[model samples]
Target: MKDTFTETVLEVRGLTTTISGKRGEFTAVENVDLTLKRGETLGLVGESGSGKSLTGLSLLRLVPKPAARIAAGSVVLDGIDLMSLTEDQMRQVRGRKISMILQDPQTSLNPSFTVGSQIAEALALHTDTPRKSLRDKAIEMLRRVRVAAPEHRVDAYPHQMSGGMRQRAVGAVAISCAPDVIIADEPTTSLDVTVQAQYIRLLQELQRESGMGIIFITHDFGIVAKVCHRLAVMYAGQIVETGPVAQIFDQPLHPYTRALLSSVPKLHGQIGRLPSIEGTPPPLWDRPRGCKFSPRCPLADHRCRNEEPPTVDSPAPDGSEHWARCWKPEAI
Candidate 1:
């Protein structure tokens, strides 16, 4: 309930991450820029391979090394330049100042350790809690995240819990440090519809309690609508559009954004063949000459095909700016 319009928690500029493969080097996350304010949620939505996950990892400097590297960018967290930090310094920042909730709790959680031990480990790494008090702090975290019977569940290993419970355990670890920001990359992917809804609400409640910023990466527009205050639509490693959630949903300026929204099933519309975006996304190495989405865009022209469009500001009726990377935003 506190004001969400507080100080900026994270700011990323021109974040470019590249991967070197047998095929050659290609940018997995290119020229990305984003900002997150305290208590606000920013949705990073796009189709598979749009580099949403890569972007999150790059923010933390966790991109796999040798094969993948952050080629360029500045990641400033709470006024500290993460890029300038030494490896040892960055380690202190990773779980203490920022944390990530990856999809698939089965993979994220350590099956060998009790859920409470995992949470306690994070607390030990980030805080100076007494050794004997770690268990109690861990139990408190489990209760805070809504794990059932925190005292009993604390001793349960990941495999002993349900999928939803495991995911909550992962959340408990992420929030145990009370980090300034959290990057949730499709964290609800393994849960059922009802469990997914519960998980989303749990995140909202946690955000309200801590006023921490969140970068939620997912492909589901419904999740974005429910949890995010703003959105950034990515395509082929580039951000195609970004603005307030309601403005972009009601009046999407980018063709790709419109295409993505149209693909979502409507509950009220007359039932018929569901709309689908024709053609597949271009591969990273062989991206098109101009606009990346030009090949499948109905509004594509010669200019669109030959020249990459710059991100331009398209002001909404309320005077807030909606940015889009398109040459023909007026066509919408």
Candidate 2:
């Protein structure tokens, strides 16, 4: 087996997802590219419909079949290509080599099953642990996530747990197999401020312990700041900008990236109403020919409308480079 401890855990290129409907096929994600290393966190951030969650689905081969399909992509985890796996092969990959924590635990967890059984089932499916020890293993995993009273909580059904407890349980299930990569899709959406902090810290602790790569998908910049080591900003199903977390916060290059950071409510001081980005995201089916963000960009001009901007490099102080898809980033 190859060593995953210090290797690039996940690499994706030319990833595109197509949605088929009466209105014709729409490209949900287009030529999106990113990389995640073991023990690192890469935030996949964008407004709703910007293809954040769809990219996660495409990675897991869990896109709603018939209506949507992975048109093209190369998803290499460690040395294996996930896109080329058969359904049976992919089944072994999901929740074993890679796992996902969805946005809502209420829906992801089965109402009928006890929390411990579901976790034990995932563990049994992936490992050679004996039947009697499955329950103990499940509870141990729960302890790793800092779940309270794991032994007692193990028998509780989904409805019996509070929102925060259910979210933690879902996380325990996701990490049960100790997969190399974890795709957490808005895992804290249902959580309040305090619980959200605890969850974020717990994830960090887990990553430190397991050296797993994390692809954290969310629209919240606040969460991005808390958990992400690096960030990939998506717009119109494409990564418009990416860089070290601090650099993106201080020197956002793409107009869309800048606008997004600007829209975050200022905590240091007061301002008369928060600023908002103008214009809705263009319909995916009828996206503009050139820069998809041009319609909402204040600096978008004829060139932005007529010609697609290539990715420009912006090196950071930390020796890592930043990239932005824009024609005139300095103008922003």
Candidate 2 has what TM-score?
A: 0.96
Error of 1 at 210 (Å): 0.2
List, residue by residue over 69-179, the lDDT tens digit for candidate 2.
999989999899998889999999999989999898778899999999999999999999999999999899889889899998899999998888888999999999999
Off by over 4 Å in 2: 1-6
What is the TM-score of each predicted model, taking all chains together? Answer: 0.97, 0.96
Total clashes for model 1: 0
- Model 1 steric clash pairs: none
Which digits, one per residue and each the tens of the lDDT, describe model 1 over residues 1-332?
A: 22336578899999999999998999889899998998899999999999999999999999988899999999999999899999999999998999999899878999899989999999999899999999999999999999989999999989999999999999999999999999999999889999999999999999999999999999999999999988999999999999889889998989999989988998997699878999999998889988999999998999999998987897766665589999998535
Cand. 2 Cα-lDDT = 0.90
The TM-score of predicted model 1 comes to 0.97
**Angstrom error at residue 172, model 2:** 0.7
